[model samples]
Target: MIADSGRSVAFTGHRTYDGTAAESLSAAVERLYGRGFRTFLSGMAVGFDLAAAEAVLTLRAAHPDVRLVAVVPFRGQEERFSPADRVRFLRAVAAADEVEVLAGGYRRGCYAVRNDFLVDRAALVVAWYDGSPGGTRYTLRRALARGREVWNLHPSGGGLAIRPVQPALF
Candidate 1:
């Protein structure tokens, strides 16, 4: 649950990556914290989702009041995660102040619908997209259309840097 003054930020992005993108994501989370965000919502997927959740948990060690909410697409989805990632996903869900599964099971097009749910509920979105055309891109587009703030952390074939862009201002 989000505090009255705190903003809820959801995460969406690619599920495959090299090491550089992963590090960039960690830095982006820290940047969000510095900007006064207190709650984070993650879809609990394998790649970017797991990475974002772990970053939030890591920040919790220092900022114990920060909350991580697992917005799962469906129950038992974590079972498909790799052994290490599965452990992290379970930890995230266990440590989260709130866990909401958008659907009872994996229905066709459910992940995309789940992403939309996250986008609708969040005040901001932190995405690690590699310019791919997929669910993450769809979520990013929706976030922009809703006038929500979105911070893109993907490298544009350049050095790793945090680029914060206001979709509404664009």
Candidate 2:
């Protein structure tokens, strides 16, 4: 069982993933599990968001105690996606142990709201960010400001870079 609500992790990344990104993501999830994080939160966006969720799901086979929570930006968030994308989104939501809708309908800065919520609820943040200007970077900054532990699999310089699995001293 989850040790506490703080024993959770959140993911943030760009829609476009770099090569070897998936492998790096899976490895990080496994390490997080080893570190006693039993809950994983995702924004349920395309690319890295879905990839991170799927990684948690795969690890779930061996780490059945873990939970996947999907945080959607708005009610009809996936309605504008292609048919295949909509199906994929639905499947991911269905796989989640819990779903959180940030708003009843789409609104300006809704994406930011979703990203902030993920960081707020988790003690650990795992992301694939290149320091580009986007939600991933914004979430990373928020996580840092909140003093959450973070691991950047693919940061600006490139390659796998994970923070030590220890609580932040601050």
Best by TM-score: 2
Q: What does candidate 2's lDDT look like per residue over 75-167, in tens digits?
A: 998897768668878988998888999899999999999998898899989887776788887888888888888887763532223343222
Q: Which candidate has the highest lDDT of all? A: 2
Root-mean-square deviation of Cα positions for candidate 1 versus the true structure, in angstroms: 4.7
Q: What is the lDDT of residue 47 in candidate 2?
A: 77
lDDT score for residue 12 of model 2: 88
Per-residue accuracy of model 1 over 1-170 as CA lDDT, tens digit each: 54542377899877884444556666666777787888899988888887888888988898897788888998789778789878978888998888988888878888987898788888888887777578887888888888888787665521223354433322
**Per-prediction RMSD in angstroms?**
4.7, 4.6
Give the clashing pairs for model 1: none
TM-score of each: 0.84, 0.86
Task: Name the lDDT of candidate 2.
Answer: 0.80
